[model samples]
Target: MAGSNFVSEIFLFPLSGKIAPILAMATEIKAEPAMVLAGVLLSLVAIYIASKAGGEFFNWLGFPPVLGELVGGVVIGISALNLVIFPENGVDSSASIIVKMLELTAGLAPDAAEVTFQAQSEVLEVLAEIGVIILLFEIGLESNIKDLMQVGVQSLVVATVGVTLPFVAGTAGMMGIFHVSAVPAIFAGAALTATSIGITSRVLTEINRLNTKEGQIILGAAVIDDVMGIIILAVVASLAKTGEVDIINAVYLIVSASVFLVGAVLLGRFFNDTFIFFAEKFKTRGRAVIPALTIALFMSYVGAAIHLEAILGAFAAGLVLDNLHETEVGRELEKLILPISDVLVPIFFVTVGAKTNLGVLNPAVPANREGLVIAIFLIVVAIVGKVACGFSVFGLGNVNRLAIGVGMVPRGEVGLVFAAVGSASGALSPALDVAIILMVIITTFLAPPLLRVVFGEGEPEAEEVPETSG
Candidate 1:
């Protein structure tokens, strides 16, 4: 009887221990999923409000909306504010709910903590990237291709010179000042090659110069510059990934991109004609709405598939359809996309702020000295390199050479894209990353007012200047 009772107690003890673990897991499972959903929704709403508030603040300051958006993001992301929080292992109600739901539905419990974190990060990153792509696309949709073509030659010269000087200067500066490797130096140069068209356009429009020859040329060249910048970025990214710059692969990328660009243009032309013909034939109610959106999506998809920036596809689509006379489709499309652009684009810029860790600027860190010096040198190179591009317009007929140079100044979204990519690829140090972010903000903020002063306010239409002497 005594032996039997001892055996029974031992069995009961084992059962009790197992039950406790099960209860603990059940508690965790109940809490985590709700937390994740709530976090995402809250973050997004907070971002939107911040973006809107930022725009209003910047507008009052006589700056572009982007300036406010960026500042707002930075403010929120600063460690002092503690506004943006990431989840950790603490049994906080919010995080616990998310973990619990994930565990119950997907069997991803405590062991899957890292996986869940990574997935959330990825979703945020992708959303930001898509915002950028769509912003560029909207720009394309609004541009007038016919007017753009008339200004093409001078714009081409400006863009080429603008891109080239920066590329060379930035590369040289990185190599000489930082003593970094050729690959990193080249990447740095590539990052500086991007011109922020949105900022330039806004300044031009504000000055009432949007319809002028110089304005048109600046706009056109900015678009071309974006295309060239993307190609360079792709090549560099490929090199970074493989460590071997395969000429064949590079050429393939170039060819594929070119083909997609050309194909988009041709397809857009064909579709425009077909749509006009069908609209006349069938007297359709929606007219070009369905067709235009369809074309936009198709061109965007094609560009993505070819490893080209979807913005290029959007630009191409715009160029083709911009000539559609007497159609409400163009105007309608613009209206539809404006809200999306306003919302998503700010998110992209804000994400830039979130990723930036200004603590790197602390003088307490020894590495910051290197970052500061490099940043100052790069900023000088960035400014002077593009300023030199004005010389390309020296012989051109009555062009505001200084204005053209200023138009090329702001690195804008393009610079941000480069910095983001570098950070993601682990190609940039933390300090270097922070420096690049500052470069984007400074250049963007300074360009508009400077250009306004140089070009004169209130649109007295500048004449088209030839690229060379007649």
Candidate 2:
């Protein structure tokens, strides 16, 4: 009878666990048909609350709301708001449950557990990549080509200095101290090449510098920096995968990226002209704006096909549309894209936090300890490296050197993306992965307060533009 009871209990496990958790946790679940619906609902509420809280926090700190959004995600993932909980059993809980359900229903095993786990992980990874692609598309829609161009030369110099110094410092520090492999050290250095423009943009805006010459220069430089970083990532990925760094292929990628930039500009000019001509002639109600979005998506697709980052393509598309005669159309596209970003972007950040395992820092794990030491060395390199770039701001007379340095500090989405890719690629050990994530968080979190101190202010008031009409 006891044996029979034990079997019965085993049989009852699924039903009890399911219903009990629905009542008790009221948060955790598989992304099933019903749970997906719940996730959507929860995501909306989470975004709204996060946005508001993020805004207030940034306002207080004189930084951008994006920093707040990112911090808010970190807080939620680390806190007990219980909105998007991981599987109760473990990382593989969802897969395990599904397999058990299948066993109970079919009374026979179909495949190895390892195979099923691999398949599920692959699917999750693909979904995450798609989320990132869409994010790049949204970023493209927000970019303004005219603004980028006006700030281009100075920004390029700033970005170049910013990228080079960090890469050298990070690589040297990792290779010399950690005695890590050259390839991994290069990857580590590559990871440091990213600058979080969102944070810098916010800081400049807060300090009433966004429209200033320096602010525009910073924004332009950041956009260029992002493009350069993507190209480097593609090259590194190729090198890692093939174990051979082809000089010709690397040069081809750089040349191809440059060609694309030029082509995008010319194409954008032609499209804007054609779009304006048609819109003026047809005067169609809502049909006027769809073309811009269609073009943006198409360009993004082309960018991916050409071995370039999709965000670069999207930014190109935005630049092409910028200074177009279709201001109304641009505004409409912005409105549409903003809501989509609010929903999807948070998923990316939340997933990022969820993947970060802080326990990797425990000294009990020898490898983890090695990673922690490497992380400390890398962080110091990362800080000192960018600080060194402040001296490279040439031609701008009496510029606030401290502000430039502070602006270069935040690593933002670019750094996280690099770390995520490294982690996914198996190039970064778990501990090293956590360290990179921590670095990204620290750099982003420190920007606002650092900027406030350097620039002096509680949100600098906007300066008046002199009247142009005579």
Candidate 2: lDDT of 101? 41
Error of 1 at 248 (Å): 1.5
TM-score of each: 0.76, 0.73
lDDT of 1 by residue, 381-470 (tens): 788877677667644476677777778889976787787667656677766766776677678767876777777645444353323322
Candidate 2 segments whose C-alpha is farther than 4 A from its true place:
1-35, 57-63, 78-82, 85-90, 93-147, 198-208, 280-289, 325-368, 429-431, 458-470
Q: Give a tens-digit lDDT track for model 2, residues 335-409.
A: 666665555555554444434445555689777776677677767767766666666777767566556666788
Error of 1 at 444 (Å): 3.4
Span of 10 residues, lowest total lDDT, candidate 1: 85-94
lDDT of 2: 0.60
